[model samples]
Target: MYWSVVFPGMTEGQAKWLLPRAEEGLPGLLGSIVDPNYFISLHVDRHSAETMKEALLLLESSDSSTESKGIARGLLEAVDDWLDAGGKYLEE
Candidate 1:
């Protein structure tokens, strides 16, 4: 399942790299629980969150266009805030 949200002007290559990394890194930012069905609900750690944040910052800074940079910055901020808030899970 794809957990990453695609921002405007994102390239296919960018999504390919970002989505899985985001999914993998999110568990560290958000605490996880194992369900009765043995499904892992979350994963991620401080290091992963920091790494993802750094990557997003790099993407934001490397963008040639102002719009792309803004989008990247937004994504970075969202991730940062989510981490700071301890993240959230989708309710069924």
Candidate 2:
């Protein structure tokens, strides 16, 4: 998974903390009433860096609710901070 590789040092607690906000925001970006848990389960093992990038692009272009945009931005900022702290996937 991209997150696993990119955020090798992120703790479960951190993920728990961050994911809920992302989930809350994603429905707005999708423009539908989506279940956050289902979304998280789907992406947990399947997401790639490109996927996230595309999602961000979609989020940027989509006519989403303000709450969604704000949450997505916050999630991205948190990820950026983690990356800045030297998080990387372990080489297999």
Candidate 3:
């Protein structure tokens, strides 16, 4: 679940609700699929690849250690590169 991925400490219910609200704040059109309203947008468009420069947007604790922050940034950057076209695009 989204919680396990980011907030490994939150309960099941907490994560489900937190993820969408958190996702909305990401930095790109790609990670923009947080809101359920965008399901139709994503489903209808098969090749809507995208990415978000917004990392560390975890709904979990904001005050984390430097190592944790590095890990978060690394994960976000990796996902961004994967979804984006060399970090130079929006959803097509």
Candidate with maximal TM-score: 2
Q: Rate the local accuracy (lDDT) of all candidates.
A: 0.63, 0.54, 0.46
Better of 1 and 2 by lDDT: 1
TM-score for all models, in order of appearance: 0.38, 0.40, 0.30
Candidate 3's displacement at residue 7, Å, is: 29
How do the candidates rank by TM-score, highest first? 2, 1, 3
Of 1 and 2, the candidate ahead on TM-score is 2
Indicate the TM-score of model 1. 0.38
Model 1: clashing residue pairs? 27-43, 27-44, 28-43, 28-44, 28-45
- Per-residue lDDT tens digits for candidate 3, residues 1-92, read 02113333555467567667666776442232233334322221112322233434561247888788787777566555555434333363
Off by over 4 Å in 3: 1-55, 59-61, 86-92
Residue 10's lDDT within candidate 3 is 58
Model 2's alpha-carbon lDDT is 0.54
Higher-ranked by lDDT: 1 or 3: 1
Show model 2 residue runs off by greater than 4 Å: 1-54
Instruction: Pick out the ten consecutive residues of candidate 2 with the lowest summed lDDT.
Output: 41-50
lDDT of 2 at 66: 86
Model 1: lDDT of residue 45: 58
